[model samples]
Target: AFDPPRLSKRADYSGQMGGVSEGEDVLARWSDGLLYLGNVRRVDSIKQCCLVRFEDNSEFWVLRKDIHSCYHPECHTPPIEPEVDPNSWICRQCVFAVATKRGGALKRGRFARLMQIMKVRLPYQLSSLDWDPQHLTNQQQCYCYCAGPGEWNLKMLQCGSCGQWFHEACTQCLTKPLLYGDRFYQFQCSVCTNGPETIQRLPMTWVDLAHLVLYHLSLCCKRKYFDFDHEIMSFANENWESLLLGTLSDTPRQDRCQNLLNALNSHKDRFVSGKEIKKKKCLFGLQVRAPPPLSSDQSPFIAEQPINITHRRRSETGAHQDLLISTLNSVLGTESIQTPLNFSLFVILQPFAKWLFDLKGNGTRKALIMPILQPDAVT
Candidate 1:
């Protein structure tokens, strides 16, 4: 869908006759003839191309004619929007569907994010409490499986894929099971869990973030962790089976997590599977910590600060990775889970729980919630 700019029939142009070398700034043409910022790893004067390495570490032999000196780019995004007659509306959707579907157009390139803008139907409902899945005619909707919506409407979560609404009570979400907890919130229906590539179980970013947290967890030393928090442990215990059989990730590192979870699940029969962990108090973290009551109404313990966990970096090692995986294997597969690694994971994940599942499909987050999460500082 992208066309290289200003192609010339002749190769020997006045551009950069001195030739590129390692560490010099240059733009290199990829296989598609599109130029991207890449550093010269080495020059090949015989072939009139240099071995160029892009930021992602992928290397390519880029031709001199296609190479250009680093300067301002003419366009930041591709001009891939199909040329259509302004008068014709039907062909646009039809064209995009067939083309992108068959790998003919918009093949998940650098600007694939631009595609998220297309095909999104903002559920034009007044209140989720009153909205019916029946009203969302095109997309399928699932409510809690009691065969009825309960008397009170808890918060309704929509799937990141398929744009369907779900009652949080109906889904065993690992990210945010509790109402008041500062834990991450998300939910996913079984379709997202098991369906085709079009139906994502969780947002790619969330999966990547989870893996990043795990990656850093591999670097944690025993001394950095604080007092144990059993909330995440409880949450995992309650939802272990669902997450094991359901959660999936396409990324390499994140896929390792999914594999570990599955491996843990296979050994479930050998584990204790404690019923006591289901108690809500033990499963969720961040309750208002208070001193013991001194009298009938007053408390004695004078501690004011809450035990909070934050983020940090770590050096990766074979032992560290083994420790992190073994910790998860223990936590998810057996009862010996309350380790420093587990607590560290709890904090790094922002108390990772499963209620944020629909942010991928919730188009509103990009426009609305982003401002709240990351507001510009007043000068």
Candidate 2:
């Protein structure tokens, strides 16, 4: 039998190159008819051996003592050094999940990912757009900037405790800076940042809520979904008459009344009140089937009066859906009168409407869990 060309020891051996240590599994890759092993060891003073070891504990060695270089003549630079400092470096395997770019995920690389995640979360804040589902009665139950329809360009919001994700616009509050390595990055928004520490979070002023509701209503109108079933649109239009009069009443009630009369004269052909019916139905439906009451503990989620509510119906069918909606419309529609009557209406009817639609479904879990393969993980 012929002896294989084993890596026999030469006359000289330095053993300088750090070869695979005992108990360390080695990796090998073959390309262009050449075998590349994980480690090289010098076994002879005048020659070197390429040692190959398998994850299963097999081992083999080859002598390259007399071989010349230049396998790829086109390549000019020598191989780069590996990262010895674990703190400053992450393996290529861990680089995929970061967003280190100027705009969303437009850029990549470990460093960039770290920076991008840090920027949005940092103390310096960016833009905010408020939103509330017209269908919901409790103002606190309205979706905030994160969950609303604001376009975050698909950017994700990171959770405070678990490094999980949510749509950027849906997040109510967040903490800043994702801490990794030596540096920390600020990332949480105002809501997340101030939530627990602060006292009763003031309700979003009616003005701000109105603006948001109106803006979306116009958007829906543009889409021709004139189903007139949107609570938001109904709210805006119902308030439209009162708001206009209120705004102008600041000038003079006479001037405000004059404008209303003139407008009614010009559009005499338009059955504005008949149109008001459609708005009423939608508003009533929303107030009836709106989301459940937010926890009283959460100051941010409280319901404020002077909201839009349109109609009334008996809670005969389980669809208390329609009745709940009507009650909400009536609550929202009632004038902000400083009388006992107005207060009574708000206190009595509003809670009932909110209860009808306050359906709280358990949230879905979408967190990602990485598997560990070491004893340290068990610890």
Candidate 3:
């Protein structure tokens, strides 16, 4: 068998030309029958390479040893420069040119594949949008600006700009938890804080206040659904009307009234008492039964095991009472009041509490009534 020709050594190019000079014409043979005719734009002895600008205006880095002096009769004369605008240089071999010729869809597909292989995101889009669904599903939760889903342990601040919740650890700009006082405060996210505006403030609305209160209440009661029956609706409506008229006759009445109005308007959908029933019950008393209370196995929202009734009852008169009072104080921005406990409010909320706790009628009384009477809960 015949052997292939041995590759020439680097010393073979010595004395071929004085040296690879910048702006000097040369022919670079990268491989057999594959030659590049270009001018040496730069020579780097340290890198053992030369920056060659080809006839097509594109440039490449070729080893100095690979360059040979061109002495072709026509090569001796400098090639006429194309009469293009001096400011505008064109390179048909560039990435932009290749993408333009291949069309947008193919370019995008290739880019997407490359991003997938590299586990990276496109710079222009939100990181959240590019997250893998499987990762989100496996993790079950996510925090602000995190590319992957995760459970955030720290107290989160809601960004006024994006309305997304972010933990302090995730943001370099977030300094502290929002301070609660007699008045509302605005909070902006890390991104918005450094943006054009010095500070982006979120406006406080009655609806927003109500939503916050309701969300807290839902968490406390461990309930996802709430049905506002007739009694609750009447109590809310009465307080709302009293507030609007500025005639609510109770201590801290004005503040309480405003909070009541906010709560009522915010949860109007839950007040289903007034909706007329279209279908009448049959003479045999057929009725649609309410669904069973959520089982622990069904959702993470529900407790895995039943809470001890005795322990709950004791706490109802103790800690639970304090919780209710504090909740009312925080929401209404009021001190302790002398008004009698709002029994009607409890009556309205009883069914929901019963459903959530999976309590019977007697259990509902112990669970709800005791707590209200323990302290002057809410006026």
lDDT of candidate 1 over 1-379, digit per residue (tens) = 3332332223442342344667777765332212367888887766566788888998887666445563222221223245545454232122222323211134344323223332222212212322221122111121322111221112334343343444333333333332211112233444444421131232223322322222222223212111113322233334444342243423354245444333323332111113224532212111111111112211111111221111112332223434434534433444443333332232232211211223333432334322322212110
Displacement of residue 98 (Cα, Å) in model 2 is 5.3
TM-score, cand. 2: 0.19
- Residue 367's lDDT within candidate 3 is 40
Listed in order, each prediction's TM-score against the native is 0.18, 0.19, 0.24
Clashing pairs in 3: none
**Any idea how many clashes model 3 has?**
0
Q: Candidate 2, residues 189-276: lDDT per residue as tens digits?
A: 3344433211122222232233233334434343212232345434544554333222332544334334433432333222122244
The alpha-carbon root-mean-square deviation between model 3 and the true structure, to one decimal in Å, is 27.6
Give the candidate number with the greatest lDDT.
3
Lowest lDDT 10-residue stretch of candidate 3: 281-290
For model 1, what is the error of residue 274's alpha carbon versus the real structure, in angstroms, after optimal superposition? 50
Which model is ahead, 1 or 2, in terms of TM-score?
2
Residue 350, model 2, lDDT: 37
Off by over 4 Å in 3: 1-128, 131-165, 168-201, 224-254, 258-267, 270-379
For each candidate, the alpha-carbon lDDT, in order, equals 0.32, 0.28, 0.35
